[model samples]
Target: MNTYTRTHLAFSMLLSIAGLSLPLGAQAADRMAGKMDTDGDGKVSAAEHAVAAKAMFERMDADKDGYVTAAEMDASHAAMKKDGQATDSPMSSADKIKAVDRDGDGKISATEHEAGSKSMFGKMDGDMDGYVTAAEMEAGHKATMGGKK
Candidate 1:
């Protein structure tokens, strides 16, 4: 093949790979939507939201005080590490808890967790119509990976 043809082919391949990636926030949002939609209701009512929210709250509430303080989250993180369940990279567990806590109270209440999940859901919804279509979810996932539409 000609050098020019080879270069063009390589560029095309690169573009194709790039098109398959997406942004982190968008990808996480899409994943959260799929996981949280337990009943396949297409929408997350407070009732349905409570199920996942409660689980997260329980996970973070080390003291079993019905609250998830930063301390509790830290303990949870340490346990995950002990079990080899935590990610190896430097995505600090503390940072994640801080980001999701929102109120700066050092705790992630059920309400707070639900709010965070809802915010992510809104991002994945894409069309701002309150419901996330399958296309939007896939697009968000792709965007998170920096891939093509």
Candidate 2:
């Protein structure tokens, strides 16, 4: 292969590996997507999305607007860190908040929230059951903790 082809192949491999390194919580949304999507539907309906979206919207939407601003994202990150939930990991809470705040508005919108949640859930839903049951949670917790319950 030519030099360009070899470099592209190497870069592709690195990108693939980078995608595989997301942390436990980061995959939770994909799992929830399967769960909230009742009737085996390919996509999550507004109602189904709303069920799971409410609590998160409330938490992330610091201003109570129908939207999430970038400031809210920072505030959430600060609060989580203050509660001893901070982490230096690549997929830490702060990282997630910053990543999801697309507009740098300090908060995430329903669409962004849904996408992020689905991504995290997908990683955690080991059984593909469309929801994270107690057993699944236990298993994920165990896996993350080196098999310690």
Candidate 3:
């Protein structure tokens, strides 16, 4: 390749890696949490929450197929609802698609789940402090529930 082309390709590659570094770093940080605040720091980082979110997704997947199908979603909802643990708040299957299916292929990828987890981290980590404390979580919960805090 010509020098110009080589430089352009190199730059593009760098940008791609750079773009992924943040989220991947966040995921790594989450893995370090080893079950959310295993170190007892009195705060939860976005990475930690992302880890938890992934676990939750795995549970809802049920079939261990890495994707939560509509049938799986319904079963998950039914199980939770039957136990009165659903809070009537789980997203519908279509809503799940719109929220987490970034590829628009009607399937939620691992990357999409991680992205959703990162987004939830933003909401749960109120005050934008890069960490969530109990108070922040409570406040965020109230806000989400449309209850004044």
Candidate 1 minimal-lDDT segment of 10 residues:
13-22
Candidate 1: Cα lDDT at 122: 58
Q: Candidate 3: lDDT of 95?
A: 50
Query: In candidate 2, how many Å is residue 106 off?
Result: 5.2
Model 1, 1-149: lDDT tens digits are: 56544333322221111121223245444455556577776554445444655665677677777666556655655665587443232223344445555577765566666665555455556777766644665664454334533
Steric collisions counted per model: 16, 28, 0
Displacement of the residue 137 alpha carbon in candidate 1, Å: 4.8
lDDT per residue, candidate 3, 1-149, as tens digits? 56544333322221111111112233333332434664578677766666666666676788787876656666766675587433343234555444456577776666766665665567656689898665555444444434421
Q: Give TM per candidate.
A: 0.49, 0.43, 0.62
Q: What lDDT would candidate 2 get against the real structure?
A: 0.46
Off by over 4 Å in 3: 1-36
Model 2, C-alpha of 81: deviation from truth (Å): 10
Off by over 4 Å in 2: 1-50, 69-94, 102-106, 141-149
Task: RMSD for all candidates, in order, please.
Answer: 13.2, 10.3, 13.0
Cα deviation at 6, candidate 3, in Å, is 39
Per-residue CA lDDT of candidate 2, range 53-97, in tens? Answer: 556567757778767654664465466457744322233333344
**Which model scores highest in TM-score?**
3
Sorting all predicted structures by TM-score, with the top scorer first, yields 3, 1, 2
List ranges where model 1 is wrong by over 4 Å: 1-35, 40-50, 74-90, 133-149
